[model samples]
Target: MTNILFVCTGNTCRSPMAQAIMQHRSEWNVQSAGIFAGEGADASQGTKEVLHAKGIPFLHQSQPVTDSLLEWADLVLTMTQNHRDLLKQQYQAATNKIYALKEYIDPDYEQAWTELKEAYAQLEDQKLVGKEMQADVIRKINKLEKKVQNVDISDPFGGNIMTYQKTYEELDNYLAQLVKKMENENR
Candidate 1:
């Protein structure tokens, strides 16, 4: 089975929602992790409620991203550009396999990549640290954000239930298209 990993900032929401929704398809081996998940964390109430709305029952304990997970994942889909950037920096070996979830689903993914990369290259450097790191990273992220935000699935942590619902519906729409495209390609 193809191993697919979904990642986000916290495992309590986006990635778990993706995992649960995709698990229903029975096509690939799917798992989810967070870049900075606290140990033994449960899925947020918003996530559970959203999944339940679509008749998906998901019980997940949050886990942090690991080398093992990087190795196992055939394709890694991240929730946002920030998550993608972290994965690329931390797991350079898996750079070829990592993509933003929207990047994977969007028709103009390559153009988006090109534009984002060009903007990133125009930025001073990739590795900024200490106090300067915050400003530099924000600048770099902001540049790419303008070109790709139209396709990005927004993070809904700590928002109202409606916010969570919007996030879930967007994810579900893209995921449905993703599964369809994968099936067609495989066939």
Candidate 2:
């Protein structure tokens, strides 16, 4: 079974929800982490409520992204472009494997991925924090911005139930496509 890791900033909201939705839809061994997750933190109430409403009895504890987990995931799916770049910077080996969720589901992801890989290659990790390393990656991310608006899942933390519901619907739609993609990949 494929091991898929979903990622977000805090792991309280978006990534946990993505993990639940994807795990429910696919046969893959699914997990989630945060770029800066607090160990053993509870999943957000919004995430819990959304999944409960969907009848997915899910519980998640926040785990910080680590070398072991990076090695564990066959595919590392991030909730935002920032997370994607951060991961690739920290774990260069996974650069080829990581993708923003929207990019993975894009009809032209193959081309997008190739171009993104190229852009990522141009980045120098130490220079990324400053604007110096950004010219190329910025251009690529900007092109993606035109093709996919709100490619990052909106953070629903501190929002009301309706907000979380909307985020859930959006993620669920992409996740369905992701499940199909995984099935096709396996075939």
Candidate 3:
């Protein structure tokens, strides 16, 4: 089973929407967290309204991204490349598993993985193998991943209901595409 973890600045907005969208649309296991710890982050009313409009049920409390969660996730799909970079820097070992959601769909991920292995092998050859170099390689891989073409889902935090609705629609569409891709990959 592919385990997916969605991340954003705060659990209050984008990530939560992604979590709910994925849960409803995909067969893969999914969860979400924030870069910053927010204890008891209930779903924002705007988020709720938007999901409700689409007939998707969601109720989420914000949780800080933890080391354990990182370890558990087979795939970490963040909202932005910066989020992926920051998390990989903090947890260098799992860099291979983390990706921006858009980047996850790219055909170039295989090439990125190849480059990462080569970078690590070079480090091993130089006897300079360390977590720092691992982290650096991860950063480079994530940069390459983000080079994959994708329209980022805009953050609708603190926006009006219309903005939330628009975001919801966009996320739902992406989630549908993602679900199909994941299913095909599984098959």
Q: How do all models score by TM-score? A: 0.80, 0.81, 0.76
Q: Rank the candidates by lDDT, best first.
A: 2, 1, 3
**Superior candidate under TM-score, 1 versus 3:** 1
Q: What is the C-alpha lDDT of each candidate?
A: 0.85, 0.87, 0.81
Clashes counted in candidate 2 amount to: 0
What digit string (tens of lDDT, one per residue) describes model 2 on residues 1-187?
8999999999999999999998788778999999989999999998999999999878889999999999999999999989998999999988989999988888875666566666666664445665754765788767864665546878898999999999999899999999888788879
What's the distance in Å from true for residue 154, model 2?
1.4
After superposition, candidate 3 runs with Cα above 4 Å error = 108-151
Ordered from best to worst TM-score, the candidate numbers read 2, 1, 3
Task: Report how far residue 111 has shifted in candidate 3, in Å.
Answer: 7.5
Worst 10 residues of 2 by lDDT: 124-133
**Candidate 1 backbone collisions, by pair:** none
Score residue 138 of candidate 1 by CA lDDT: 65
Which stretches of candidate 1 lie above 4 Å from their native place? Answer: 112-145, 149-151
- Looking at model 1, residue 132 earns an lDDT score of 75
lDDT of 2 at 85: 89
